[model samples]
Target chain A: MNKKTPKSYENMLEVKNLKTYFLTDAGIVKAVDGISFSLRQGETLGIVGESGCGKSVTNLSIMRLIPSPPGKIVDGQIIFEGTDILALPENELRNIRGNKISMVFQDPMTSLNPFLRISTQMIETIRIHQDISKKEALAKSIEMLKLVGIPAAEERIFNYPHQFSGGMRQRVMIAMALSCEAKILIADEPTTALDVTIQAQILELIQKLSKKLNTSVILITHDLGVVAGMCENVCVMYAGKIVEKAKTDDLYKQPAHPYTFGLIQSVPRLDKAKDGKLFSIEGQPPNVIDLPPCCPFHPRCHKVMDICRNQYPPTVDLGNSHEVSCWLYAEHKELADA
Target chain B: MTKYIIRRLLGIIPTLLIIITLSFFIVRVAPGGPFDTEKKLPEVVMRNIEAKYHLDEPLVVQYGRYMFDVLRGDLGPSFRYKDHDVNFYIFQSLPNSMILGVIAISISIIFGISSGMLAAVKQNTWVDYLSMALAVVGISVPLFVIAPVLQYVFAMQLGWLPTSGWFTNGDGWQTILLPAVTLAFADFATIARLTRSSMLDTLRSDYIRTAKAKGMRSSSIIFKHAMKGSMLPIVSYLGPAFAGIITGSVVVEQVFRIPGLGKFFVQSSFNRDYTLIVGVVIVYSVILVIMNFIVDVVYSLLDPRITYK
Candidate 1:
């Protein structure tokens, strides 16, 4: 299925109808089933989803870093800088990995090599994508570390990862991710593992660094608060598909899809009365390995209609760059057109 | 680090003392005496031999005498090999055994690590299967069986290399080859299996994925990132494995007829040569203690988080 989107120079990265599937012993797992989105230059796009909704898979696909044998991008176009990254050779993709597009992972404790010192990891990452001397790379590494608010970075650089605390390790990861001056940074749940206070600090650091470097970012997370605070645009995903996409403010103000609406309402609000019963989305996420032919969310959707069970909903643009994929919107669109 | 090494060295003294005390008593308690041969010597001749070595004295006196000689850096005379002292036999034969042990261990580590890495990197493929299959064979079959089979194939049938006997001169490696291979075969398999499993675990670690995300080459990731962590298990194993291999050489020595400490050890045990038995045991204990100490030091080096305190 060719679902290619027209190339746009204004956008730094456009993932057009990407499908990353895992051929496991049980069955085929549609981890990222035909999701599409674009990031404009210097913009932060948040992909908010529950566990196993394929948010992380989408980012891995963009980097072509998915482990094979069990996983493969069955079809897609990852257009970056007007070139389809999916079609590029392995060697060419390697150059883009940390050079033009870098990533920060969730668990900072395991992300940095334990045997290597902080300086070694950061300097090596810098030298991989740039032609620079070891001394120059070391200087740049320490500079990046200091920029991330790390104290005593010059001395700390010589210490192994185990010497760093959880917050400090995340800072180092960020420094390494940004050391190459990448154009787009993909952070997969970067703050999920930190404390609430540290989470806010890490988010602020990422935001400040991205703005300073003028680098686009794809921040994958399940916390709406993080998205609302740091991201300019947000994509709400469910069962490996984008169910809602809008400006962060618009998404918080008016969630179109039932899933997105349920997610927002589930969050404990301070303004609400002190009630024991919190709003929760009923039913579990559908098994991606054996997903239904129709809309995967129909089983759990509160406002499910007749067509929702028999057919997949088409994505409908609701003007002002807001989009929703739900039968309710589809029906509304039909009535409006008629 | 130097303090740690010194502390570990000092600890070996009491350890060695305890080992020596136990082995001394245990050997004395066993049924046979040093002069109890099938062809008995005259009673007067036997008495003279026992008296010369202070064996006729009371057990407590004999123990004190032995300890005194040991403190004076003397292992006493061998009862079996007359006119030769215990130290003479040990010093004469230890170098050959050390050469064999070193060669065997080196071969085992090099082959084991490489094969294990290949198996892990190509998991579930033919290379992995073949290497694991060979490793299973190596581990299951006894070294005695391997020794004869190798000698039969390479020496008797093929006639490519000498069957036994070590030579110190140039190109003596040919004579050392079969015995060393036989001695190392099982350990090689053990290390290979250990490395493969450890490497598989290391390869799956999040840091390896992080390395890949950094655009580091696969070779660099495997060698620099995965290797150091994976080596922890192998290093721990090598300490005891080194001592085991040295003692295990007794069987290989018999099969190959190579003159080494293993040959002396077996002969001394059978002949009830008290001084010789204790001397060899002490030497083996020293090697073992030092090796384990070295392994601990290497462990800290591989993983910097480990400190001596």
Candidate 2:
């Protein structure tokens, strides 16, 4: 922000009131309602949410990769490295994508071009950003592939995507994303399509490589355990808004929003022996189409108050930068005034 | 790939045999022989004529004899055309038909791919609507109607071309222009519609999104990533289409007054010239089979996932 002169330079990314809407025959679906967050260098920020909660949409908005026609970013300003990405021209914006910032998608099977060799896909990504020869670009691609734990990466790079296993394809995806030493990496459920063991390996590879490259990461996933292990800070999104934000440890110790509380509770606790039944949050996520100006998680909140139904809750700051948008978190005097 | 082609070429023998046998019998099933005439010849003269052409022999023996001749690459004598064999007529017209067909297909590919890609990339816009509307007209109107209409406009009304003829002057290729364009019109429409839809589907694919996400130049994304996938349908179609066009369209040839294999195909049937009819069929079948083989090879090249084995 113009007001925070010095701190803005320190932050890697700043998303201000980002809202992405999809215009359909039924209505305007606010896939990502007004939400704000920031990421800093070498810090992994996890976006945790159930399906359709705008975790992926928010990142896609950052990348400016939302498919047009039906999809549009209604209101948003994504500031990266002191420049407004939303206002930048196409030529300028392209330099930011896959160079300054890159993303890994959810499904590895469909994410890659099947007809092309891994070398072609990787070299294309690398050569677009840097003015390198094809041979050099291919060499860099093989290096990145090897770094991501692919065996015989030099030979394998020439093979088509279909020839690779699911886990190997995801590894290639990561290698392509990190090939250029991008400042920020966005991984949208990168491990979702893989089995449990492969998922851990990919997550670990991402963590290890990004750390070595000193790349800040915005990791979007539904797995709280992944967040607990991998993220320094975490955001809990419900419907299209971030319901809570805090340091991972502190949030685990004390979840401020009922939705966050429900998410943490729902996870099977390894510390406890044979629980009778797993805890689950009641009610489905609100339909985002023409959604009301109120708390989206209100229906499922245990402490749902009258104020939550008609009015959106303001973000309440608990000490040490922990924040929650909940009527329950409001001070009695503030509640009375409203 | 070399081995596959060799095996495929060898495999054509049995297929050609079946086609030759079927045509040899089916032509006989029709009424009247090649020698039939309204005025009955004297019995002695007719028997002498029948014996000369082996028509007096049993049908099986004649078929065996014809098969023996065909094995040595001879198509036997033409019954109607004096002092000619089936091979001579076929080989003579083939180059003329091929020249016309090649020109037609070249026009179709160039116009079809560019217009179709434009329609797809600029979908729902005026460019899309205009090109698609033209394609619809092309597909709906048949060659017989289209050729004359084209001739009417370019030749009669505009006086830009000859009315109907091949090589108006000994070296005049201007005659080929009208007919080739007419021949290409329908196929252009087919290719355009196919390319438009296939490109649309491929453009929406996850890989295309990844290409965009990688910040690829729009031209590269389209040509490198989207083009090959969209071309699959068109490549598969090109085989049979080439076979049909190379032999030429009967209506296309007739309306334009051009000599092509299709003319022979129509006349040989009417004349009940059994050997000539079978020879034409053999040419069309060989071209069709060979074209399909080329398509499969191209498929493997375009999509690494495909393998002949």
Candidate 3:
């Protein structure tokens, strides 16, 4: 067990060797398999993956929000501010959930209770963690609405969720998430359900607010473009495992893992030739329930080798905090040893 | 909102008029007359009886006369009772039936809601299975069977309560209990099933997940968040269920020997008391319409997304 924190020692949250699985009647589905990452205070980490690649599951496990019976955190350690959140009692965990660590979900249309007024929802959230009267909490809610650039915040606060548009509802969601001055916020594809124009506005709001509040953020999305624009560091996930991780600029400059390279190439770029066709990775992501014995991506890897079919590749550091799991890296390791 | 309520109220007038017209003709069209008896009277005596009540008038004229009298707050003479008019008999018997109905509905709501919520919260478990199984029994068995079974158990065998009759003094509650419980069981089953299914759906809603993510206590999430959303179906069910209970109380009233409107309604129908039957039908229809109107109002209250407009 590596119990040591990195020497920099300013991490706000650390997820260590987290393994979340679902016990379906068919079989066990390994949704999150031994993923680890550290978030420095005020840092933004983007987890980029295709759909069903465990990006959302990882974030849910961090918040301990996975539904049981089918979904369970098989093993994990979520250390938030040096406390093991999984080990905390439910009552104590409640304090950390929406207070220290808040979350914004994918669909703003369904996230807010349609029966309740926006002001009531916001004020209740405020009062849940803070010792404040309804009037004070209401004032705070209006202030949050104003902060999120909702026009006529005072009047709009009295309106229900159905009355708000998609972008405006998302703004309300963000306002609620930030109302408690949380130290960390997990946004699970927060702008996926909105228009392209509104997506930019929401992304800007999240980035600007995180910077202002100095709140660490874990932004999970499938869009690499979103990661490129917003994240400082990015982790590329495939088949419930992190295959490549690097500083965003370095990742864009020279992706080491085959999967990461394929992802980068797949994006249609303005700099590329107008007549050239866009690149796409062939083959589907591996089945999580019955993954191949060796490297999970070997079946789809363009750079596959005999070793990739025989055994799982170990994660190798490629210097400058960039790491990748691939037999190509293992060949480098063997050469270095020789 | 006021306009909506006014519109709903106005809609009931035509509805009641239709109900009154239909019931009036149907009762008259039936073969027996209110004056008929086992021992046949002389033809002249029968003619005088028919003329006294204006029964000899044409059907349309009779209906028009009845409507006019009703507009003046007159539910005409009860042939079976002879001394009291239909209005006097109904008003006298209504309070007992109302008390019984209110008690039965209250019992159903309290127990039904709790059991339903429990079943939903403990879904696919013994609690859910048992409550649903009980609900199936309640629905499958008729209230007539339930009334007798309850009478036998609580009244005959246990001897804890009186077997039949309404005591107007202090012990009136005891007399109503067996009948009320009998009436409540079927509605309880209906309400429980409706609530369980609706609550299960509400609990699974994304907003419930949001509530959980907000770190709300489980009780608050269930009651404050899920309960209100779940109530829309139950509220809608209550309007019809209330009317069903009142009309369906006939057998229970007979079984318990309670002098409620249901008993009088049954006797009037048997004795061919035209005015009394018509009077009861009109009252029941009005109650049904008003109950449904109230349900719509409550529906809007529970769900801010719903507007009458």
Candidate 4:
């Protein structure tokens, strides 16, 4: 990347050869295979994929947020701001979390404590990594709520989670996540559980906050439209690997990988010809617990080669910050070989 | 909430009536009368004794009379405790029992909840092991055993506290410590175990994870998020447990030589003191009812999901 890159950008996060596996009772499940990516400062790197495609797991690995016993990062280098966070001590990792980085989860209803008023939850979080008094914490919380575009912030702070709608609860979650002014915000499908209008509002809030704070974001979602609308850089994940990465416009214009093309085509496009059929990717994603020996997506790739069935394709550069892992481009054979 | 509470209040009628009727019959059928003794007395004297107490009457008539007396705020005289009315004996002993119960419940709840939470947060550590070990001991060792052992260790061997009685005199609270601790020992154990398990469950909730994700401190997550959520189960256990504590273990009272209600209860039971035994049973039943009612109310308060009805 350094050899070919223009020198105007600095990466906020760089994850290399990250493998997060779950030591389940049945077998070892490689939730995140050997995946590598870099997010530049203030960039919205959208990780778009189906459920079980390891997008969420990748974000969790970056945050060191995986619940252990079953889930473990067996091998990885999650370098945030020149520090390998995976190797950091527990105490230091905690400081990095919610200080340098914060995460917003899905299901706002279950995510927020129903018994507690929003003020109590938000203020306590402010006080955790800050030495502020209760009054200061409270003020900061209200400020955050206002920043998230919550109306009547002062009155809403005292309301319980049940009193708020799903959209409002999610806004509150986003507010709490942003309260620490984290450098990298990992929002795992933050709006998936809300209505479409609310989803738009939450995405807009996230986009506005990212710009305002200059926070690099890893937006993990399965919706291609979400990635298209909000993210500048998109990582198309399939079965625990990033199969394609590029500038969103370039990828949408000319998808290099067969899987990426299939994903984009599968969605109902308004620009499609009248009576044009919606494309569908055939077959379910390969089961992680007992996956095949070759490329996990080979069975469903439209441009599957003989080699694709037996050997995994190394990522190939399509030039100008675009990369695709596929055997379709023969001229890039040397890149795959390397 | 008012409707729910009113419905629960209405439930108490059948509960009390059943307890009264059961106590009446069970006390009567327990193989001995209050007048039973080894020495024989003159026939006329025995008849007079039986007639005065209405002991010679039919069982149904006796039950009716007992219910009437209870309704009229009279529990009758203690046939065994020569000089005292049953109410007098109960009133004399109730305060000491309540004190023991309150102290025991308070200590148990505070220590148990705090320790359980610590154990959950710092799970698999020494603190967790220590708290769990205490729970195991509390559950396995009966109060009868714990009371005597505590008395011997704290009173006789250590000499740090008094050995027996509710008070040094009739009013001063100087000598009640040993007995209170003895009576409370098992209650503490039960509460600790319940609190620990409930806290463990609460700590595992998704909301707790969410709180942590929000950058909430471990202390706040445990106290505000987990502890409050765990209260419903602990509250449910509290009612029955509180009644158990207030009733005072008869064996513990005897071991500590405390002239509490538990001591009176044992004496009455042994001598087949019909009116006294019946009176004690009725009093215990009422305590159980009131405690359960309180538990229901507390349950509704702690969990909005629960309704008293």
Candidate that would win on DockQ: 2
> Which residues of candidate 1, in runs, are more than 4 Å off?
A1-7, A305-310, A332-338, B37-58, B168-173, B246-248
Q: List the residue pairs that clash in candidate 1.
A: none
List DockQ for all candidates.
0.70, 0.72, 0.64, 0.42
Ranking of all predicted structures according to DockQ, beginning with the best and ending with the worst: 2, 1, 3, 4
A-chain TM-score of every model = 0.96, 0.97, 0.95, 0.94
Candidate 2 residues lying further than 4 Å off, grouped into runs, are A1-7, A270-276, A333-338, B31-50, B168-171
lDDT of candidate 1 over A1-338, digit per residue (tens): 55455666899998888999999999999999999999999999999999999999999899888988789999878999988999988778888888889999999999998998988888889988899999999999999999999999899999999998898999999999999999999999998888888998999999999999999999999999889999999999988899999999999999999999999998888777476778899999999987877888988988987777877888898988999998787766573453
Docking quality level of the chain pair in candidate 4: acceptable
Model 4, first chain, TM-score of: 0.94
> Ignoring the other chain, what TM-score does chain B have in each prediction?
0.93, 0.95, 0.93, 0.91
Model 4 Cα lDDT, one tens digit per residue, B206-295:
677776665555776677788777777778888888887787667766776666677767788788877777777777878888888788
Model 2 pairs whose backbones collide? none
Q: For residues A37-112, could you state the per-residue lDDT of candidate 2 as single tens digits?
A: 9999999999999999999999999999888888899986888888888888998988988998999999999999
Off by over 4 Å in 3: A1-9, A270-279, A305-311, A332-338, B26-56, B78-83, B169-171, B264-273
TM-score of each: 0.93, 0.94, 0.91, 0.85
Of the true interface contacts, each candidate retains a share of: 0.66, 0.71, 0.62, 0.50
lDDT per residue as tens, model 4, A134-158: 9999999999999988899999899
For residues A44-140, could you state the per-residue lDDT of candidate 3 as single tens digits? 9999998999999998888788887789998878888777787888998889888989999999999999988998889989999999999999999
The per-prediction CA RMSD against the true structure, in angstroms, equals: 2.8, 2.5, 3.1, 4.4
lDDT of each model, Cα atoms only? 0.90, 0.91, 0.89, 0.81
- Highest-scoring model, lDDT: 2
